[model samples]
Target: MPHPDLLFPPDREVRAIARELFALTRDLPLICPHGHVDPALIADDAPFGDPARLFVVPDHYVTRMLLSQGIPPAELGVPSVDGTTVQADGRKIWHLLAANWHLFRGTPSRLWLEQTFADVFGVETPLSPDTADDVYDLLSERLAEPAYRPRALFTRFGIETLATTESPLDDLSAHARLAAEGWGGPGGRVITTFRPDDVVDLEWAGWAERVERLGEVAGADTSTFTGYLTALRSRREAFIAAGATSSDHGHPTAATADLGPEGAAAVFERGLHGTATAADAESFRAHMILEFARMSIEDGLVMQLHPGSVRNHNRWLHATHGRDVGGDIPQATDYVRGLEPLLSRHGNDPRLRVVVYTLDETTFSREIAPLAGGYASVYIGAPWWFLDSPDGLRRFREAVTDTAGFYNTAGFVDDTRAFCSIPVRHAIARRVDAAHCARLVAEHRLDADEAAETVVDLAYRLPRRIFRLDRSAA
Candidate 1:
């Protein structure tokens, strides 16, 4: 499974240039400014359980494809909410994935998985019903080795720094431990990002309880609207103490509102009582985006707004399996009118850094690029979720470059929960960027030296600078 020319152009002259650019950036330390990898895994530094658990079970990208083709998640060892029925045998799960390998053809999941197998696990033979057991045994042996431990692999991955998302209620004990161990300090780094969706979204199930927990965590009286904002600000300060450089919002849309104190408090009262209407929920989320930006200005944490995914689209699956089980689907998102309120308030502020991500590709050229082009605070996020493939990556570069240009865009972030795929994901991104840059060189739109510099910026410099990851808070 050699991907020597995986995403490189077929033209020999163009590919030679791409290879040169790739050589310059292929081994740079990974800047995972945004992702969903559990910090507990890095803090605990434990050995991975088995091959199937490491590969198939935890990856929604892998499980979703299997589930889409009539395979129940239970059959693939994905635990239900109650843990009543999930495939318990690792070998059996591997066999199942092996039998259905063809389902991932032409998919990014397949490219990442195969690259991981070859590069990370040293597996050369293709996986299939025949080689499943052999591959499983080899992976089991490799995973048992000391180098395969979470912390060891963290170093092996050459990660300059990593950030994991957490709720406001999180105590950040793992981050504290990492800091105590000198991991999140000057040299080693693993920080947290504040994700307040559970408490901010009025329609979220258990929103009341999460807010109460937030009150306890922040030691604020959340019974009043003012106190709730205090609680949020307090928790954000706590996250900053734990080495957070950014705050994330996963709202359903890019909406923002600027209601004054009385109006905001009235909406908060309705939300606190669980009597808020659908419009109220939208209004509250919109208002909070503005508030989060204000907080970012005061605290210096970069703001990341990821919108447009309709989470848990399958109602039955959502009820049975809970969230992030590959049930989230992309929807069309409007950024211009939706973000007008917030942009009008803080778009020109040089102190604020807002990274905007969308699952909808349609918004890249027409809406997102233009917005980033105008606002000093806004930066267009990389192609994400459904648009993270090679073609998607190229399309993103093409779409946004014309308006936003390279500097107005944030560099690549994996946004993955799958740990082993980090290197492969970054490698693919580097290659795709090189290919894009080589084309610009070929067409004389950019000089070769300039393209080389741009490729490094896309790969290494921009993400570090944009996320403020280069700062030594400790």
Candidate 2:
């Protein structure tokens, strides 16, 4: 069971205020603007296969930490890209996770998993080597129930709107099926997000093929630069038609460029031909960020820039398991200089909504808060990636609250790949926000009523308003 004061302040007066502030958000519905839950899982509404698949095999956070402790992914039933060999036994993986549970202490992974084990699965006995099989047996039995299906859990979790990301090359058959089933639109439960990284990032391994596939899907020519832009526009329209309200760009940096069409076209052709140098690719990506911004202004799709992640940093793991196996690392980001091109041109535009997320926390006070404070288009995204923890969330509030304020922020987003962690993650964020606000009230900085209202915004209103979800829903 969750303790009443899990993430609250320890002081008597402040803890009381924190508890009061949290009550306002306890029953509030979740508004997840960005996440990586597979659409097929909800579309199929099938029973989760087993305990290991639900909690261990698919979550990179869990696997990466275990891998860091010198545990092979093969031992945890993680199959390779080729699917050549895999550990097929579920009980064995569960045993390994349980025995190694001690490694998660004082970590966010433990916070999420333990809360999930207690609240989601109704297990509070604590997990360890001795009780691994007992817990696994309980999870397997509950997952077998129809109530434990993905859609059932979605409804039970009080998720008002959940957006899953897809690439330009994707057919979005899962999203199409979801819409056909009536789980879409501004007010609908599930939606898709336009992620064009695969098609736009020139140095990506299959960039040429992904662009060709984009042309095929959108019925536009790709051999020419004009044709390529047309193809990208068509795909954006397709994404919008399938209920996408935003476009996500995951770049190496927050760089933006405004190159003329001829200059861009020269680089584009060189890129597709595999003749573009590293500098050429970087410039092309910067220019495309500006192009995507223009597209966002033309269309209604909000733009999101998630930059500064050195993705797939582990060469061996990346080669063997492919991406999202948690080898990414965050480096320092120069948001001020990098975003100048886009901000100088379109930062004041009321129509353009650019929510910026950074893996680099050092930029929170220096570059990010100041930028959001200066520009009308930019809104600071919630603590993202590795920073989605208790202390990280608190630090974000402390860092940006002075400059950006609560309204200028995009509110909390559970930018997670794990399905089971969504509710617990949101719960943790709410507690952290409440406690942060409580400190303000305790210091006589704000009134209790005012703090309560702000937390409600942090919990529900700001996400919907900044993400433009409440332009339609409450």
Candidate 3:
């Protein structure tokens, strides 16, 4: 019941085995193949600003909880788009979280925050209204230290490689800086992933302007459909040259289209002219997923598809606060039919590697597991977003393991924007997996040695191999 071993299983016999398994993987190097940590932090090696800006302001997991309890976002210093000023006090913001610590009693955010405070900042006392000031002072002092700089912590966290998402318009100057310094071979390295949703989705805000910018950045004409495809290919090549190994798509649905060139051109024209019907927009988005797959097949970059989130569900918040402010909500997704067009063309190919994630948990047993099990190119993505908690992860293993098995799954991905929570999230997953493996040993489903190997694979090796980091650009 101590803070050190909070997540370990309770059974006497199983706890011992789980503890042993945890010991094996607790010190292994971290493999973070997917995340949203800003590369500028690492490139500039700047010290984190303050407790609230570093933790509360940027993390939706923290802000959404406070908002649900009737607290206005401005109280927590959430920025506004119309040039209005919010609260400017950092210590006061920390007090709000400390006072409401009970709200996170059984939540994963509590676990991650506690571990971060204790391990990362040496703040061992429980956070509360009484202890808030002292904890704030301690964290503030620590954030000013040289060792707490982003690059230093990247090395201290024992991360072998960390991937950050970028758009096609990004020149990857930060990544380019790291590459030129030869920082990726042995010491910690940061890489970029191609996230083309802004340019690919016709309904997205500023899509026409973004497409025009993409064309300019790629040095290709945006006037024709053929020219657009060529520009997309050029952008992918730029990502590859800047040390990217994957492309990420966060489409609203998993639909894929295989329209002929003429049909595709018509859709492209509608998108360019800003006269696209909703159906035409959907058709264009769907067709681009197939084009992305084809490009992946040729370029050797892994393709990641995560669909089924009805983004910006809180229209009031979106209009006031812009996107990714914890307003996104998940909807049910259909994979068997939605991905048929893409899979039919590239599913059997050994050269292509596609990892798919879903917010709809029901599809795990019924659709995604079976699809990954049968296809050579498809691999199941780990639990993400709303499903990244302890119970959700256990349920994912139970549902998918029978059909897809261990090898067919792309290992764990943190998928976080909270930089300090990276190690905490990975640690929680490793403990959960070790507990699962311990249960298998207790039930005689697996021998101890084999279970140890499985835990290592789930935690480290599979991520490296699945993301192709073993031979990734140095």
Candidate 4:
């Protein structure tokens, strides 16, 4: 049997109320409007390879926690950019994971994994060191079956829509292919998001080469600043054609600058020549933020800014392992003065939609809620990264709901690499939201019927409206 402590809705008086609330929204169709799962998995529609690759490697949340215990990432099968072999044994990796599973107690990762194993795979036995091999063999055999393929699992999970992030240099052929073939019947919508961080940041390695490639793809000169901007614009249009509804920006800070035409051009030229100083590069990036805002206004794609991450904190790990392998750390961020330039220019515009996210939880009540509460274009995103857990979600609702309320906050986004955890994560969010609403109802702040309606809004409707997925035809 599964562990008694595995389930959420802890055994207490509150558990009864939480159970009722969970029942109301348990089977709601999942709307995963934003995430980081690869498009190729959905496009190819192939069965997952093995248990190790499926569970241990692709999930940075799991590996990062394991690394905290002195386990190297190479042993977890995190591939290098040049295609080096790491851990190859599925059972060994599973054993390692099971031994350290206690490290994830009370974490959302543990909750999602337990739910995926019990609810999806029907594994009655809890994952412990004793049962690791048995679970691995069972999962491996199941994954080889036809029903476990990406598209089939997507359908089985009741995922209405999934958006994958793509770089500006990406051709998006996979997304185009999925759209053309219609993977999920007549309207299999696997959309793309425009993430231009690699090309936008002047400090990134091979920035000039990526810019040249962007120009080549968009059929622009790219040697000058104007040409570079045109190339980026063209790429955005191409992504829009492939069924994108949003653009994502992951800047080091929320800072934005409103530079004059000449000043912007000068910075861009310096970037092209690779002669831009650190301050010059930052100024240019800030100017580009304004340009991105203007482009969002023109293109009608929602803008999402995820700031305050100090990516690749361990340079040696980055040198050996590369990015997105669980080395990124969060830092304190400022959204008031940082976002003033962009907001002053376009904050009142009704056509624009900008969702802001922060790793700095202090900003929720102090800065973000007020900023989004007043601005026409701004809405606060759900707590992300380190703050995506049950406790984090609860803290977020308690902190921001007073000022921002239900409307000013955009609903949940999985923001995960683990595909199987999508429904589980969303389910947890719905339950927590319902529990929060139940508290409000108990306090006589909101009626029972109103709480029910708001629960549905938080579960399904809010994300659709925020991400523009509620278009009449969709």
Q: Please give the CA lDDT of all the candidate structures.
A: 0.90, 0.89, 0.88, 0.84
Off by over 4 Å in 3: 1-4, 184-188, 472-474
RMSD of each: 1.5, 1.2, 1.8, 2.2
Candidate ordering by lDDT (highest first): 1, 2, 3, 4
| Residue lDDT tens for model 3, 105-215 | 888788788889887777787889999998888999999999999878888898888998999999888887787777532223788899999988888889989888988
The list of candidate 2 runs beyond 4 A from truth reads 472-474
Q: Global lDDT for candidate 3?
A: 0.88
lDDT of 4 by residue, 452-474 (tens): 78888888888888888776622
Clashing pairs in 4: none
Name the lDDT of candidate 2. 0.89
- Among all windows of 10 consecutive residues in model 2, the one with the lowest summed lDDT is 465-474
Candidate 4: minimum summed lDDT over ten consecutive residues — where? Answer: 1-10
| lDDT digits (tens) for residues 323-441 of candidate 2 | 88877888888999999999999999988999999888889989999999999999999999899999999999999989888888988999887887899999999999999999999
CA lDDT of 440 in candidate 2? 97
